[model samples]
Target: MIENRNEFLSKIAKQLGRPQPTSRPERNFSFSPQHQVLANATQEELVDALVEQCKNIHTKAITTTTADLVATLKQVVTDYKATSVITSTDQRFADFGVLPLITEHWPQQEVATHQWQERCGQDNITFAERADVGIMVSEMTLAESGTAVLFSDKDKGRSISFLPQNSIILIPKSTIVPRMTQAATTISAMIERGEQVASCVNFITGPSNSADIEMILVVGVHGPIKMAYIIIEDQ
Candidate 1:
């Protein structure tokens, strides 16, 4: 196999009238003009752009103040008539008083949270799959693509965001960046600082959709059918 592979490569090189380089090529690591523009965007501009872009992709973006977040979430639960809900175990969500609001507004609803110490195993999966709403706190959000970054670990399970029919992401306005590059830089900095990054970083732009069959667009084929982002401006 080695001989055959070398011969094939030699033949290709001969056809091109040149020898194949044996060293890694130099890469130009410069930002594009579009990226530069996004990089320089102000926070208010990023928030506005994110909301508009999110809507373009069929995702709902709702801005709320820290004091009004509980009220906003209540409205969301009532609107969806959600009877089963799952929430990430991130302390920020708890600090934002999401758990108490859930209990107060939907006392009869089934609730399961991603546990930091113990993997609930099949029980967690069942709850997530059957959940009418899944609430997650994003690590960061990108304005250019209207994407939310979810770093999955023991405390924030991947299924908590993907398995539910509907997803509600609680994004702190402070974490909103102008583009993917900025978000990537933050993750890289974390790694450089010896932080334990999650095994999987999911970049969700919108609810799962595809235009594969007959070029007809369909939503929620593989993930949530409905998605809503609640951006907490005060947080």
Candidate 2:
């Protein structure tokens, strides 16, 4: 794709009866309405927006202090009545003091916990498919849409978010942005820095809800049946 990008654009330019531009044209407008929405929102306001938006997407979202993160997560686990669980190997699980849920708490409750294993191959998919709940950290949270931005890597399998019956995402308060505009800008900056972004970046908006069949809303058709967000005040 990279090698043929210029050629692809040249064909489009020819159809439009214009030469291919040497570079992107300058923006004529000085301000963008999208960039203005919630542009000056405080962290608390952003959290509020996320919670409100989550309601519309059929997701439950709650805010908690870092001190109460583990307890809050445990409550969510119970709310979902999770039996078998799978979690991504996110460092935040350790940093936020929630790793015990995967390491000890669930085990004490006689629940099976499976962490994504890159070397184990299909074992990850098999476990994720059977797991009652999938837990992972949201790299970026979009307040406007109550979306969790997840970047998949070797230690984090994408199946954990899709193949499970329920999804419980841990979000850091500081990671909340106004909307996708800010999220895209952050990713563009990473590209500018020559940083390698994950090839599969998922912008998941709550649970999977489809309205394709006669415009009837059907949940869990494409992903988890239920999705919840526990926002941690790590800022």
Best by lDDT: 2
Residue-level lDDT for 181 in candidate 1: 81
Candidate 2 matches the true fold with a TM-score of 0.87
**Which 10-residue window in model 1 sums to the lowest lDDT?**
109-118
- Per residue, candidate 2 scores C-alpha lDDT tens digits across 1-235 of 2798999999999999999999988888877899999999999999999999998999989889989988898888898898999999888899998888789989999889999978879999999999999998999999998999999999899999999999999999999999999999999999999999999999999899889889999999978999989998887
Quote each prediction's TM-score: 0.83, 0.87
- 19-69: candidate 1 lDDT, tens digit per residue: 966676789778466568576677888899999999777899999998889
Q: Note the residue pairs that clash in candidate 1.
A: none
TM accuracy, model 1: 0.83
lDDT of 1 at 59: 90
lDDT of 2 at 82: 88
Scored against the true structure, residue 66 in model 1 reaches a CA lDDT of 85
